[model samples]
Target: MNTQFVVGESSSSSPHLSCDVFLSFRGEDTRKTFTGHLYTQLCQVGVHTFIDDEELRKGDVISIELDKAIEQSRVSIVVLSKNYAFSSWCLDELVKILDCKQMLKQIVLPIFYDVDPSQVRKQTGSFGEALVKHKERSFGAERVEKWKAALTEAANLSGWHLRNVADGHESKFIKSIIKQVLQEVNQTPLDVAHYPIGLDSPIEDILLLMQSGCEHEVRMVGICGVGGIGKTTLAKAIYNRIFLQFGGCCCFLSDIRSKVEELGLVKLQEKLLHHILKTKDFEVDSVAEGVNLIKARLGSKKVLIVLDDVDHRSQLESLTRERSWFGSGSVIIITTRDEHLLYGLTTSEIYRAKLLNDNEAQQLFSCHAFSYFSPPQEYVELTQDIIKYSGGLPLALVTLGSHLQVRSVKEWRYEFKKLKAIPHGDIQKILKISFDGLDVNTQSVFLDIACAFHGCYEAEVIETLNACGFYSESAISTLVQRNLLQRDWPSLVMHHLVQEMGREIVRMESQDPGKRSRLFNPQEAIDVLQGHKGSENVQALVVERRALKGVKLTTKAFQKMINLRVLKIDNLYISGDVELLSKELRWLSWEGCPLKCIPSNFPVEKLVVLNMRESNIQEVGLDFQCCRSLKVLNLSDCKRLRSTPNFRGSRSLETLYLDNCSSLKKIHPSIGNLDSLITLSFSCCKKITDLPSSICQLKSLEFLDISSCSSLQTLPVDFGDMQSLRSLFA
Candidate 1:
């Protein structure tokens, strides 16, 4: 009889064991039959198995080496043949394997080969006879009783039964056994995040989506969001939680964008197939061949695959092009910045990653910065500053928090100042990848919004951008799809860090603020205008109220800015000829202006928006006669204004707001010429007495507000002809 313990390969210099499975069986009964075949097939599939190959005389106790192997193994397989219970060594191995299963939570699988499961469980037939003979010998009663109990407990476990398979299908049975062994072996969890705060809810939400669909159908899920928004982290957490449920037929192909660039799709496909199949023998020569192989091999087995950081549609086409490529109940997850990449996927659900809320952001930040759940009392205010600046992005919070760890309060303040001027380098690099992939025109449009149009109404910004020779509609759509921009109701919103990155790009264009393409800093703009350092490179300029308290612009201040298309000034003093402003201007917002009137020579033909609310102007200027492209005109709270300007030349005007122009007296008859007017508000224009008949000719007018016009007497005779008016605040 061949009775020996077979030990798998273990590196002598290594400190830990590498064995995945330990085999426990009678060496003589099925040594060259079922047990031997099982061990060989397990080895062929790259499983590090421990099998007894050495032949020796029968002994009552198993060797120490054999016991240690069972303890170190991740799983133990017991091949129970007719005479398996006859060997004392096999019974001792069973007791040790069961002890490990309880103490170490090792997986135990009992294979009832050529024997009924009930025979093993009840210790009947050969099992009972062997134990009775051992008891009759010098073996202790306690040892015999322990062997019998281990057999009963192991046989009760959920395991394979050879008798259940077809009559001549032992090969199929072995294959099924190997598949289960692999499932238990590869159930190791992945490292999700250092501080996985706020991860539970998202994971639960994704799980619900997974279960909401029919169990027999494959589902593709896309997690889309801007960079640093935690798409990959959420995907990883979901993968870790459910990977074992798929029976270890799972693969997480991380950083797929980078992997594709470094090693072609064929290599990635090979890695994916090798991971799920548990073998490295399959070779893919090309992407097409790999696709066919994946569809053919994995089509029958349910799998979980996560494609992280996918950037292109082609990546999806090559990796998970069709739902039929995967089996029923299979789930394919993809995380990407561009949501459009998921549009072609069928039977899919898209989950947009949301920014962390205040509580979650605090907890996540505190974990990385202070190594606690919240910040210390001494740094509460500073911590809030960091959280606000992070704008709820998890990546920003984590990276910035880690950067500020172990630093003094003063250092933290200084670092925050630097961060405001420039986003974190790593974060910027990641976000810039999406920006860098855009076409030249779209990039310019993005820069425009990042510089001057953020928080502005989407329609107004689009009009202004269009006036500046951009295809604003398509560009804005592209930006939204890329996660670089978001439409919040009527306005467009960009992440604080993304805006900083875009502005930083403009800042790097030239060392001098005058030479840069856009100027957002009030001081920088004041300095450029005051020093007469203006240049054609300056395309947009914004100056806030506090910075313009004592500053005044001269006639030549904007003469050299020939390409300037956007200009926003707040409560500023202008002591020069406004006619010298750039003719290319498309957007002009001058709040608290002290001028009596806009000079007739001032350029307004190309202007799309003219907002001078709360200004000191006494009259609506005739210069508006050239504003054929103007879409929005807001002159609210200009208390000294008397009447509306003639609208003969402003045929494209869509929104006109003269609300709170207290001294306004009458509506000009030329208002009938505005065929495109949609909104007209003269609320609180208390001095106006009557409405001109031409006002009734506004066929496109949908909103009209004349509330608090206390002096008005009556409506126009043809007022009911304004059929388009939906909302009227009389």
Candidate 2:
């Protein structure tokens, strides 16, 4: 029996449905014969059905209890027997059922028993006679018209015609009706989320993918994103929306990551088989056996499966390894943080879940905190602050909103202040799961990014990190695949809270700043530096002048931080004796240096990036003669009197920027021997300049810019011989 059905907007939108089916029929006609047998079968199949078996006398209107039953039922089965319209109670019940069909979008299936569908729809024959008798008995003309309309609407619906099948056999007809009713009732919607904000667009997108020309083939779709970004929620919503279309052979294996740990793979495989096959009779002793059973039994049955929170590729291998294991038109959905786990799926089938936008985040937060779509007027700014802190991550918003609920504005202010200092623990716990899954080296790379290099370009960061003995390129790809890091073109982006969590992890390593791997707080770095509490464990530190007023640092501050790989300080005054700094330092950004040159004793040969955009340096000379590893040297806007350094030893330099260095003059002749130079820019130098005849010998230079160099004149005779140059701005 074909029992596939669709619920209208009203039905799907109604969250108050209490019963599966409501029977509307006349007690005098086929109630005991046809309707009673159908109700018995529905109960046998575990369908929650409502039948009016009471002996109450017929009246002009249905009882209030009956009224509620019709409104609460998800599907109302109306038995239009020969005498169904003869009773006023049956007509009243039919009228109420039809009302629910329009208002609540309830499923109303009318079974035409022992009567012509046209006769019932047109109010002819027994249906017409019953209506005429009701009018003659003064059942109210307006009420009679409502009954007529209800009968016509119900009869016109697509439902069972008893006489058209099984040659009018009552037993066969009742069995078919039960089967259809059971199928309709078994399609229960899964609970997706409490708020379910920003899910419609993703669900729509996935649905379109499923419907895009591959309907006849089994398709595997992957929903991948970082933890707490609503991948599982989206998968559940999509499952709820389309599971019924695959009949009852659908199973949502939730928390597959944890469930696999708690109950072995065999249990999960059993769940798949039991849910689809609809019986617990099947038993498998091992995963291999379960796989065989799943393939042998379900190969011909179309199914819909959602594997939520799948982390390991092995979990997928043991569950939905191949598409041909199920019947054609089947759809398998997998939600994971690691996009790489979905190996066999095509790009079109993999959906990377993104964080919510401002509007969506606000609505979701407001829903949880205020129990409304928006916050109150007095809390709008506070709400926006929370949303901004959430970084559009739905989990953060939900957690923050829920924590702030029922608190006063003053309490919210205090909580926000604390939150700025530290991420909420609930949010951290979930975000950390992705980080915790990474290998140690990848974890180190992620911590570096979160602690210091979040907004830095990927290429620049990679060069520095790679110089520090990290497998940067591969680790970055791993982090990106796991959704912990976002590759925003050249720059890498991380969620604000994830960065906070990483920083917090470093902080939690020890109470003393000297012991932490990274220090971003100015006061903490000052304490560690001035107190002689520095340690080799501190790998990165930043001290912005804006955060610390009139802070002075001695070169001795770096005496103990031998492992420091990244150092970024802005406008710090240093006037004490110089000490040897970290030999491992690779990236150094001192925006406003107060020195004539890098401290003479400082070790910088390992430095990959030396950015001194605006500094007091007098000249670029022999201080960097041994810095063969330098890849990028940014000395822009260094207005002090200067000349280009002799590039005898900085052959590894790939980019040299001298933009706005008005005092800069002369290109050192040795620059021709710097075979690895890829970019050289001196835009706006406005100083005495002439091309070195040997400049054209930079065979590896791909980009050369001399725009706005007022004093610059003449190109090399062999400038066109710089075949590797792709862009030249003169």
Candidate 3:
């Protein structure tokens, strides 16, 4: 009996080929029984095998097409029966097969169906009889030569010869072939390790760094490595260990790249101030002012600071200066990828992050993939194969293994084939392998959140996604499951890198560049707000583009935004139009806006904070009289301003920042009325002379930073009245 093979048909809509195995067999001999059984067995094992059943046109040369399919496949299976050599078309396919074997190094497996090895090799018995007719036909001798060579090669190669095997034994034979294929597939390079949970070498190294103590002026320790190599994790571990030991500590995980991209270094310095000083309203006018403040205030404290994901040397310079700027016990730990940055820092000590070994990679993969310390019994063989294929890379191993965790035997086989052939550098290949395992809707949700919405409110995302016709709570759940998106209390945050990848995918899905919605651009943001207006689901608006002229605002827009809390509009060209803002607004930034002055009737009392940095306003006007309830006022770079607004009567002003009002020479002595003031910053007011003798009236002040006021010499005699001040910069 001749063994027959059939090729699977695929849809044209999906251009990418998916099958791992392509089976080639002559149909006439075993179309109804043996070949059919073999195809079923292949599918049952999840082999994703393709066998052709559709008839080929007579005299149609399928050589080129078949060769292309063979190249696309990882392995090719040939079923040999007695009459297989009779067809000239089959002979031509065999010729291409030998070519594939030579050129592409394609894997080929031959199965003999109740045919003697001698008969196949010499074209004897039924094979010989079929060749005689070909010998009598056109080009018979040349055809015979090729057939004899193909049979010889098939006979000599390693293969299974079934002699009169019954249908009951077919499963055993198929299983044997599967075992061999899986064994070959399982030779992947993976690392496996066994150790107590939550204990690693990096932890010990961090402890040692901490114990070394900060005897030098500026003790800087840098932890450098690639992304996902556990740099942040290690930094967090260290921070947790030592946070209680220091008198003051702050960890900033801001994305330096995004911050520098959105607001220049000068603005980032202000942000750092807000974090370090423990106030949101603080700002610094320039890098020079920031550096001076750090030296004068944090200079003598035994502080512990962790700057995670530091990408630029300038960021480091602007943040931490000489050892003299910090007290003897202060420690600063920086995590980054650029060794050059570490070398450029004022400190000398550095540690290079290394990739995990095989044992560690396997353990990490197994924990994520199988949700245990080891692979389950049923998937042990396949898990070993997956680990090997991941090549000891923990990220790939965990990503792929997690994808294959719940799949069946056959599914694993199919996945193994596809994964083996994928290019190593294809991040999508790794991510998709995991993503495809998610339910279709969950995949959609992941892609949407990863692409369009990040650092967005959870309730808003759910509502927006649901309104857009994607109602998949399960998908959102799956995203959280896969660590693609995280739910932080009420908001959803995507890792910066994952969001970037998601946008890349979304960009790939669209051809029109203008249709791409940008979260950063001011005009694009306005369009988004307009599109979703009158809906209570909107929570935050980050505007980076300048608002257009004559843009009208109505109470309806503000009234509907009951949940809105943060309204950031930088580089806006404000007009004289009176706009009623939501009283519920907690954070507002109007940097680089060209407003001549704030609205006289603006409700400043309800505002918890206000930032008007880099605006063209020459004066704060008497509008400051109504801001009795304000807590933070940032006027860092309002260069056109010639005087400080009188805040001596404002009792609720807890934090005041006026870093770069260089033209202002005096502050109203009535500033002493702010007894509730806890933090005050005036780092770069070079023309300022003396602080109010009444400044000592601020008995609640906790931080007084006046580092770069070059023309000013002494503080008020009553400066000691700030008894609660734990931090001071001169």
Steric collisions counted per model: 4, 1, 20
Q: What digit string (tens of lDDT, one per residue) describes model 3 on residues 200-289? A: 576666555545543444467788754555566566655544443342234444556457767877786665555455555566788898
Ranked by TM-score from best down, the candidates are: 2, 1, 3
| TM-scores, all models, native as reference | 0.81, 0.82, 0.35
Mark the regions of model 1 whose C-alpha exceeds 4 Å error after superposition.
1-76, 84-187, 344-348, 623-625
lDDT of 2 at 73: 86
RMSD of each: 8.6, 6.9, 26.4
lDDT of 2 by residue, 1-730 (tens): 1112233232122255678999888878876688888888888888888888665434566688888888878788888888888888888888888877765556788898888899988999999999999989997899999999988898899998987978889889878787677656776877767887888777767776676554668888899998889988887777766554564788989998889889989999999988887778867799888888888988999899999998898888888888889898888999999988987888888998988999999999999999999999999999998899888999999899899999999999999999988789998889888888888899899999998898888999999999989999999999888888888988999888888888888888998889999998777888887787889899998876456557777878888888989988867766665446788889988877788866546567788998988889876654556786889989888998478777786668899888998887766788898889899998898985688889888989999988998887777788889999999898
Worst 10 residues of 3 by lDDT: 3-12
Question: Which pairs of residues clash in candidate 1, taking residues 3 or more apart in a chain or in different chains?
Answer: 4-54, 5-52, 6-51, 6-52
lDDT of each: 0.85, 0.83, 0.63
Q: What TM-score does candidate 2 reach?
A: 0.82
Which portions of model 3 miss their true places by more than 4 Å? Answer: 1-494, 498-523, 526-536, 545-563, 621-629, 648-651
Global local distance difference test of model 1: 0.85
Clashing pairs in 2: 11-105
lDDT, model 2, position 320: 87
